[model samples]
Target: MAEENKSCAFRTSIGGQALIEGILMRGPEQQAIVVRDQEGNLVEKVEALKFIRDRYPILGVPLIRGTVNFLDSMVNGVKALMYSADFYPDEEAAQPSKFEQWLDRKLSSKKLEGAIVTLSVILGVGLSVLLFMVLPTFITGGLLHFFPGFPMWGRNLVEGVLKILIFLLYLIFCSKQKDIYRVFQYHGAEHKTIFCYEAGLPLTVENVRIQPRHHPRCGTSFLFVVIFVSILLSSVVFGIWPITNVWLRTAAHLLLLPLVVGITYEFNRWVGRHVQDNKLAKVLTAPGLWMQNFTTNEPDDGMIEVAIRSLELVLPSEKGKDEW
Candidate 1:
């Protein structure tokens, strides 16, 4: 009977990430990772989630929670990625260097993994900030130096354009990679399954395969919104206090990142809530959805099966409990 009801009504807070030959789904109470091994058998690992907010309530506050949750997502995502990668190791994974070997021997296995995952998250965040935030500011400021008469607004505009351009190019580059294409296909499957569930349809291969691959609440959308919000916020801040030096501008951009993320998170929540009924909300999410063109591809039946199973594991026992 539930399978027969296809009327779309609400969205769920549950979301997922496409991984190497796998999918990771996060729900209200837990997260699950399902991977298709070399033998074509499905294997899964599920963990009960413990929220940081549960330990520190203040971190759950709206604006503050965005940054907190982003970090939490990064950590979990990296851990899941590592786990999935372990199943499909490189053809030639180099031997650990002397220092790395020393650390491995010195630390417990769990501690070593924790250290590596923490380091990966840090490096990931660092690389993202440098490439997307700092690099744009550096280029804009460098160019503006040659034109002393360029207005602050002009400088901000250039930086914003550069940010968007770099973001687009990065996605395009990733999409072109042979390995990433499969991940993107799985990404599509994730979106499709979420859409099918939200529409009250049974999660079947036929149902999910026909669903749109792009989702407004996707991480790609949130990332784009982060850049968009930063552009708007930076324009205002840079207008107020013009910082011409590349290094100073880069520092200012870094400082504003948390605020940008917070605003984007709140905006995403609002958009996610209103997208079904509000015209403006739909418009707001269009670009991010469009960006999915590069980040998502049509998944095959097996990939859809992975998505469906991954979603099933994480779905709450109570209906409507996961409603956004």
Candidate 2:
């Protein structure tokens, strides 16, 4: 763990996701997914990279890139998960439901798959927004209803605290799930392997095993920053707008989400660039890193092997091409 804190040889723009008994790594030139089958054999798949920004340069701009990249990541992550899940079907392999059958009949196989992934992304983002943003607003509005004179500042404070509380509870619930526990272990392996790579250590299980599982640029940290930034941004916007209606306030939050996400993305980029040398940047990311305790666990050697191989497959051939 101590070695994980040392200044890295260099950071990489590469990132990864932990899937069902597997790891998905995305690099500059390609992406790789490696899953461990029930038979204990590793299955690997690789795909060439395609960037939406290549055709739509404006989407690559700092603020715009955040929302675009966020959606892109969600879509890709969901697809990777679905791929891994195929290797571990339910014991009974129940037949498709009526709705599924209807959809299969109505849409081509490709279209059906695409529709499912798109719907998954929408539901995932919608749930997050409702849980972290809308719920807090309504809860705060109700709590302060009796106190008509309650200051907006106080109201915002209550909402902010509630948001954090709800988020923590959600993470706690996920960590307690039996199936999710193993995924979290793979999450840890992904981080530790990345740490090893940044430190210029050999990508061996022994080396990754000793590294820290929490990472400053983790998706968990990115989500935390989004919440933190939204709290501050919402407080300012609501203070000026002073929308007393709970529904209106919720609408205002949804409207401002893009801006909040943009700002958070830029802030993370700045911190990622400076975290190695700047004490302030490290301090800023401390909360997110601490939250990893609920989202990651010590992975076994086998998990580390999978993570290492997955990362290696996605690394660019040209030296330094993937450097952060």
Candidate 3:
């Protein structure tokens, strides 16, 4: 088994999300969540993954898949987060609202859980838009009113910069929170374990411990790439048409977001496949890797164990099937 593991050299498509006290790993065929419960016991749940592309083949096409995958990831991520939080509930959390109470009384437990997960995903996406999309455009619009002579291209540049700044600030603020710090540690563990696997090493805590906590394929990196691509694309679009109206510019941005995400996803995929030894790839991924310093921290051995367990449960049965 060890020798077989050592023979693989390619990166896997398998990826993970760090949870409150757990790690969630998704492979081609299965998804697993492994959490360390309040009593220090490892708890794991695994389910066969049913890809949307399987049912709707059109959705699997390259550019289209990126948007679909993004939304699917959001839903899965929110659900995983909710599951992890259940194992470590806050004693001081507010009591359920009357509407929440009514829902609880009317629905079965499983249905209620599903509703909560759906709402959480929607809210998460809404928050992301308000922060990274709507906020920066509005801020730039306000600035344009103050300086009516601001260049159209310059407006795009300012909005892009503002988006990146807001993103960085958000990550920095979250990293400082007590609970989020622990989650970041688990994030580090997830990356390290994935690195160890790609290196064809035995998935022991010690092996994972010494690996780098940054990975080229991280969603954080994808997000940075999205921001970068958006800036470039928006500048080009606005430069060609030269729109001065802020609301119109904002509307244009919303329309262009799917294209931005698709292009960024393709770029990230290229970087991930070449990053091992390609200097150009390394340079391309540098910003995201640097950002990992704020979003990921070294995990303790116990956390490493959770990450490894989560990963092991989702490993492809056929060698190289998960190749990137």
On TM-score, the candidate that comes out on top is 2
Alpha-carbon error at 7 in model 2, in Å? Answer: 2.4
TM-score of each: 0.96, 0.98, 0.94
Please tell me which model should have the higher lDDT, number 2 or number 3. Answer: 2
1-324: candidate 3 lDDT, tens digit per residue: 123323445889999999989999999899999999999999999999999899999998888888999989988998888888888877777577799889989999999988888888878777887888889999988887989888887888889999999999987888798878999999999999998888888999989898888888998899888888888998999999998787887798889889998898888888867877578998889999899888999999999999999999999899889999
C-alpha root-mean-square deviation, each candidate = 2.5, 1.1, 3.1
Better of 1 and 3 by lDDT: 1
lDDT of each: 0.90, 0.92, 0.88
> Candidate 2 has what TM-score?
0.98
Write the candidate numbers in order of decreasing TM-score: 2, 1, 3
Expressed as tens digits, the lDDT of each residue in 196-228 for candidate 1 is 899887899999888888888999999999999
- Clashing residue pairs, backbone N/CA/C < 3 A, model 1: none
Instruction: State the lDDT at 306 in candidate 1.
Output: 100
After TM-score superposition, what is the CA distance of residue 166 in candidate 3 from its true location, in Å?
1.3
Off by over 4 Å in 3: 1-8
Ten-residue stretch with the least lDDT total in model 2 = 1-10
> Candidate 3: worst 10 consecutive residues by lDDT?
1-10
